[model samples]
Target: MATTAISADTSARPAAWPRALLLIGRVALGLVFVVAAYTKLHFNGAWHFSDYYFFFGMAINSYNMVPFWAVELMGRVLPWFEVALGLALISGIALRWVGIVASVLLLAFIGGMARAYVLGLEIVCGCFGNSEKLGPLTLARDGSLLVLALAVTVGAFLIKKRAERVRAVLAARQETVSS
Candidate 1:
């Protein structure tokens, strides 16, 4: 058996345009999550930290709908989850899974915010701390983040689908030639 030289073109490039866009979205989402988490972690004072925590408590309790401990846990871990998701997005490892998870998380946040808004709760949103306010404007901002997360999911899946198609075509050609 003789070995044949493979052309350089046979090697895959680092990333194409679609992958680049996906990467950018992932990084941007990750940064936002990280920043939000950072703001919460470093927040101080009676209103900034305490008011946000109290509002979250209200949401989890559903205005006295659920348990108090559950509300506390929800308030405590929410920021950490965002931070973790952001790190995963930035790492680009298991991006497909991460993007999907991030999208779901965003949807959950949107729903919570919407519910609180409908209940006529005066909240800070705490998404970006006291800097940002709640209401239609905040909902729009949350929706925008969700949109980005969904785009990241779609883009990542598209890349994977393209890779699978290319692999299938190459395999089929190889089979036909071998036969």
Candidate 2:
């Protein structure tokens, strides 16, 4: 029996560019996190430490959104998380989970910037590092990151879904022939 031809365009050829773009996005986000953590822990000194400490404290003790202990734990752990996620993205392992975690972090950053903007607080986003100023423009700058994180998330999802579909199709064909 003659089998129907599978179109060349239909097969998921391993494209270098998509992987490259995803890697870029992952590294960018990861670098941002690692740098932000480093700056807060080092360069900006007391003020940066104070800012992060208070910010996290509020999230835990005051806001009651994320637990106080959890926020405290993140204060020490976030930078490492960034480093790990960045490495995972660049290494091309578990891309989907990395994308999801990055997305969540970006969303949180956006929310913080938006809150500061609305509250009329003259604060630096402390995104890349501590700065003297922040405003709607800064928030917009962070929004771009949210967009990038989203793109990465979607790309990872698509790749995984396509792989799943291909595997399912192959398995079905095998079953049919065996019976």
Best model number under lDDT = 1
Q: TM-scores, in order shown?
A: 0.77, 0.70
lDDT of 2 at 10: 32
Give candidate 2's TM-score. 0.70
lDDT of 2 by residue, 2-118 (tens): 223233323555567876787788777667666656655565355454456555333333323466677788665665566677677666678788788888887886776676667
Which stretches of candidate 1 lie above 4 Å from their native place?
1-15, 45-66
Backbone clashes, each candidate: 0, 0
Candidate 1's TM-score: 0.77
**lDDT, candidate 2, at 12:** 53
In candidate 2 the C-alpha lDDT for residue 150 amounts to 85
Write down the lDDT that model 1 would get.
0.76
